[model samples]
Target: MSQTHSGTDATGAPVNAPEHVIVIGGGISGLAAAHRLAGAGVRVTLLEASSRLGGKLYADEIAGVPVDLGAESLLARRPEATGLAREVGLGDDLEPPAVLGAALWTRGKLRPMPKGHVMGVPGDLGPLASSGVLSAAGLARLPLDHVLPRTDIGDDVAVGAFVAARLGHEVVDRLVEPLLGGVYAGNAYEISLRAAVPQLFAAMREGRSLIEAARGIQRRAAASAGGGPVFNGIRGGVGRLPLAVAEACRALGVTIETDTAVRELRRTPHGWQVVLDGRALAADAVVLAAPAPVAARLLAAESPAAAAELGGVEYASMALVTMAYRRRDMTRLPYSSGFLVPPVDGRTIKASTFSGRKWGWLGEAGGDTFVLRTSVGRHGDEADLAWDDTDLVRLSREDLEAAVGLRAAPVAARVTRWDAGLPQYPVGHLDKVARIREQVAKLPGLALCGAVYEGVGIPACIASGQRAAADILPGIVAAGS
Candidate 1:
C-alpha cells in the first residue's frame, strides 16, 4: 500500500509528506535538508555537535561591526543558494560584489590579472603579456600550445599536469596556482580537473589545444546572456545564510538542537537509532551531512567499507586574518578589488580581498575603516598557522606593505583559523564518492551529502542536501506504508 500524507511546500503550498528524518549535522547542508523535509511535511530533528548552528558559515562582531568570519559570498549562477535565500525572505538582502577587477601580487610587483582566461589559462595573449604575470620565456612558450597536437588525457588527470603540459610551468605557477589556491587551497598538481573545473575539462576533451578550448569556453560564457556579477552576498555577510535557513526550518515545525553531538548511529529494525547526548532518537531516515572524518566515524561500525573509503579523504587547513584600518591611516588603497599571491613566491599570505571596495554594503557600514582579509596556508603548507595571532597579523601587514604599499597599522585585527578547512579533491575523487554512495544506499533510509561528496561551494552543498533529503523521503514513505 502506498502511504500519503499532507505537508506544505517552501512557499506554504500543501503536498505529500514523509515520516520523520534525523539530520546529523547542523551546517548549511544539514539545515537545508531539514528545511526541505519540513517543507514537505516530514518531521525533522537536527543535531549539532558544536554550540553554533552554522558550521563554517561563522560570523561575529569585530570592533563593533558584524562581519562574516567564514564564507563571504555565494556563487549566483548556482540557483541553490540564491533560491533558498528567496524562500527564507533574504532575497531583498542579496547583494553583488562591486564591478571591480582584482590583481595578482607577485615578482615584487602588483600585476594586473589577465581579463580573458579560464581559471588562469589565457584566452587572449595580449592581456597575458601586458599583465606582467609571465616571464619573456613564459610568454613565448604560450603560443606553443596553439600548435602542439592534442595530448591524450586518459579518464582523469590532475589540473596542473594538463595545464602545465600545454602552457609550461610558468602559467601554472604564476596564474593557476593563485587562482586555484583562492578556491581549493590545494595543489593544482593534486586537484582533479574533472572535479574542480568540469567545463574546462569538457572543453579540453574536444580534441583541441587547451588555449583555444579555454577561449571558446570564455566566449560561450560571454555570449550566453545577461551580464552580472558572478557571485552574490548577503547585505551583512553570507554567514547569515545558515541562520536564515535554520529559522525557516523551525518555522516549518522542524526541531533543531545545538551543542548536541551524535555519538553513534545504528541501524534499527525500524529506520535507525541515533545516539546523542546519551539519548536514543528514532528516525525513518538518516541524513549524514557532516565533514568526511565525522561521517566516517559515525558510519564506521555500521559499514566499515564506506568508512574506509571516506577515511582516505584528506583535508587542508587555513586561517583568515581580517584587519580594519582608518582611511586616514593609509596613504592610498588600490583601485581594484584585491590581489592573489602565487605559492611559488613563498609568500605567507595567499590572497587578499578588499572588502570595502568589493562590497559597497560593507564599505557603507565600515565608515572610515577600510576592511580586508588575507588567507594564509594551504595543502601541505601550514607553517604560518603555528605562529601566534599577533605574529600572523604582523606578517600579513609586512606582505601588504610590500604588495599594496600600506604603512598604517590596523586599528582592529582578528584571526580566525579553520583546522581542516578544505577537503582535498584529488584525482578519482568522484569515483570514490560513487563507491561510498553505492555502499550506503544498500542500506535503506541512509544517505550522504556534503562538500566531500559533491561541489564545495555553498550552492553545491545546498543542492546535495536537498537531493539527499528527496532521495530518502521515498524510503521513509515505503517503510511507513
Candidate 2:
C-alpha cells in the first residue's frame, strides 16, 4: 500500500506524495474499516467525534460491575457479530442468556409469551390458544389470516398495515407493534414491512398466506431434528467485544484519534481533503462509517445527490433506565426474561428486561439483588426523552410497579439517553437506499457503511463495515500500481 502526506506548505500549490487513507467516525463500522485496511498493509487513520472510542457500544463501571449503556445483546444466528468476536479473540467470552422465555404485559397482567411464536406471529396455534394472554375473541380472530387475500400492490407498505391486512388488527396492535417497537424504537404505522421483517414478507409473497408459511416453517424446523437457537449476550457485558476490537486495531498499528471529528470533506484533483478541527488532511480514499445524518452533513457539498439521499433517512431517540433492587422487597418475580408492553396498553415504557434473571451471571448467584433494564421513547414519544434523569427514573419505576407489581424502590439506578440512536426504516426505505447507493457509486474512492443501510443490530453493523473495507482495500492496493 502507498503511504503519503501532502498539502500546501505556505502557498496554495498542491504537492505530490504517496497516498494514505482516512476513515471518519470511530464506531464499530469505522473501527472495522480501519482495522481491515491496516491489516491489509494500508496506512489508515480513524477519527472519532467523541473523547471515547465506542460510539453506541459504550459501557461504564457501576458499583464494581460493567454496565452497558447502548447495545446489550447479539443474535446467535447472525454470523457477522460472532465472526468478528472470534477475530478479536473475544469468542470465549460469549455467553447465552439464562432464560429463553419472554412475557407480555397485557390486560393488567404479565403473561408468558406463547411457545412456537416468532415475534408474536404464531407458527403453532396450540400455544397461542392456551397462553391466555389474548382473549378467546382474539384467538378466534387469528384464523381469518387464512382467508385474507394476497396483497399485490407491488409497492412499499407500512408494517401495521401489512400485519393488520394479513393477520387481524388485534395482532398488529397487541403484538407486532410492541415487539417491533422494542427493536426499532419506531411506530409500526410508519415502519416499512419490507425493511423491518423481509423474511415474513417474503413468506407471504411465496406461500400466499401467513398461516401456511408459518406451518411450512414449523415443518422445516421439525425435519431438522433440532430447535432453533436462543438469543445470547456476553458473560461480562456487550462492551467487551468492542474493547477487544479496539485492542486488535491498536496492535495492527492503526492510528486512532478519539477526540478528532471530521467537520467537512472537499474533493480534490488527486483524492479527497478532510477538515478536522481547523486542520486539513488529504487522503487517497475515504470511508464514511458514521450515522446517515452525520455522513450526510460531511458530504453535502461534495456530492449533493448522495447527501440528499442520505439525509432522507430518519432516526429516533431512545433512553434506557437500568436499576438494581433487593429481591426480598418485591412480592412477585417474573419467571421469564421480562415483558414487552404494547402501545395499546398506553404505557410509557416499551420493554423491560430482567437483566439478572435473563442472564445467569449478571447478578450474584443465589443472592438477593436483582437488576432490571427498561427502555422508553421513540419518534413520536420525544416527551419521555425530554424528561430529566430523575423524572425518567421515577416514571419507569412507576410503570414497572403497575405492570409487574414490584413495589420496592430501586437500590441503584442509572439513566442513559441517546438523542438519535435507532434509525427508522420507514416505508420505501429500500428504494431510498438503492438511490443512495447509486449516487455513492458515482463518486470514486468513497464508501458508506453503517446500520442505516442494511440492518440496525450489532451483526449488521459489522457486516456493513467489513463490506466497506472489502470495497476500498483493493483500490488502495492498486493505487500504488
Candidate 3:
C-alpha cells in the first residue's frame, strides 16, 4: 500500500497523486535515479546499506588538505558526469588537469608514454620505438602486423591475445598490460575485447592493420572534437559529486535513508513490496542499483537467472596509498604527472598519481605539502592486499624511491583498501549482460543499473542510472493513475 498525499497536478486542482518509487542503494547511480524521479514529481525514497552515499567516489583529507580517496577524474568527452555536476551547481568547479602526460616505469627506467596508441596498442611505430618501452626484438615484430593474416575474433576475444597476435607478446606485457590493468585491475589477456574497448574491436572486425585502425580512431576523434581534454575533475574532489547530487535530490523532496538495507523484494498484485527488518514499503516502481552480490540476493526469488549471472560477476581488489611530503624534501621528482609499472617487471605497485602536480586545487591547498598516491594489487594478484596498512604504505614508499629517486619520508601517510572494488569484463561479458537484462525485464516495474552492466567510469554509471529512471517512468505514471 502506497502512502499517498494530496498534491496538485499541472492545472492546480488538488488530487491524490504521485507514484512512490523506492531506489535500492544510495550510491551515485541510485541517487541519480531518485533525483530524476523526484524532479518528475514522483515520491522517491532511496535506501543505502552503508553509512555513506558515495560508493567508490569518496573524499577525505590528508595533512589538512582536501583530496579524493576514490576516483579522481571524469571522462569529459562523455557528457553525463560533467553535465550532472553542472546541473547540481558545480559548473564553475569543473577543471582539467594542470599537469599533462604520464610515463611508464618499465625496462628499469622511465620512458615517455608512446603517442598514437589506443590503450597501448600503438598506431605509429616511430613513437613506440623511440619510447624504448619494448625490446629490440619486440620493436622488430610490430611490422609483421601489416602482412599477417587477420586473427579471427568470433563473438569476442581477449584484448591481449588479439593485440599479441597482430603485434607481439612484448607489447602486451610491457605496454598494454599496465595501461589496461590500471582500469580493470585484471589481466589484459582475460578481459573482453568487445566489452572493454568497443571501438577498437569494431575496427578489428574490418580486417585491416590494427595500427591503421588505431590511427583512424584517433583521426576521427580529433576531427570531431578538436582533441579536447579527455577528462575533467571538480575543484575540490570528484567525490563531492555524489554529495551535491544527494543535496539536490533532498531539495526536490527525495527521502534518503542511509544504513537502511533492503532485505528482500516481493512482487505484489498492485506493485512491489520492499522488505526491511520489521517493515515493508510499497513502491509502484523500483530501481536496483546495489553491487552485484547484493543485487543478486535481492533478486534471487523473482529473477533467478539474473541473480545467478550477477553472482558470477568477478571483482578485483586493490589498495591506494596516499602520502603527503614536504615540498622542500622532494628534490628528484619527475616532471610528468606520474607513471605506470608493468607487472612483468616484478614491481609491488601498479601505478602512481602525483596528486599535487595533477590537480591545481590540491597544489594550492597543500602549499608546502606535496601529495601523491600509489596503487597495489589486482584481480589474481591480491596476496599483498592481505598485508596490514603499514606494510602497504612501506611498499608504496619503496616503489616511489626506486621510480623517482625520492627518499624523503612522508609527513603523513594514508592507506585506503577497496576489497572487490572493480568488476572484471571477461570474454562474452556483453552477452552475459544482455541475458541478465533480459531476465530482469520480465519482471514488471523493475530495472537494474550500476558498474556491473556497462562501463565502470563515472559518466557511464550516471548514464545507466538515468536510463533506469527513464525506463520505469511510464509504468510509474500508469500505476498511479
Query: Listing every candidate in turn, what is its Cα RMSD in Å to the true structure after a full C-alpha superposition?
Result: 4.2, 5.7, 4.3
Question: Model 2: what TM-score?
Answer: 0.91
Task: Compute the lDDT of residue 87 as modeled in candidate 1.
Answer: 88
Each candidate structure's TM-score, on Cα atoms with residue i matched to residue i, is 0.95, 0.91, 0.95
Residue 200 CA displacement from its true place in model 3, Å: 0.6
lDDT of 1 by residue, 1-481 (tens): 1235554555767654347789999989888888877877788899888899877788775666678888889988777898889989999999998988999998888888998898888888889989898898998888888888996677789999888888899999999989998888999989999899888888777787787888898888877636965799898889998999999998899998888888999998767899987689988789999899999999999999999999999999999999988867755778888999999998899999988788888988888877888999999999889999999999999999889888888889999998997899999998999999989989877888788887888888888888888776642221101
Better of 1 and 2 by TM-score: 1
lDDT of 3 by residue, 357-454 (tens): 99988889899999999999988999989889999999988988898898899999999988989989999998999999999889877989888888
Q: 1-481 in candidate 2: lDDT tens per residue?
A: 3544444423657543335678898888878777777777767888888897777888664445556777888876667777778888977878777756888888788877776755556777777777677777777888887777765636677878776666677777777778888889888889987788776667776646776666666666556535545456776777777777888988988778888888899888878899988899988888898888888899899888888988887888989998878877754877778899887888888899887788776765426767788998888777877789999999998998898778788888899888888889999998988888888878777888888988888877877887777666543221101
Error of 3 at 465 (Å): 0.5
Model 1: worst 10 consecutive residues (lDDT sum): 472-481
TM-score of 1: 0.95
Question: Which lDDT values do the candidates have, in the order given?
Answer: 0.86, 0.77, 0.88
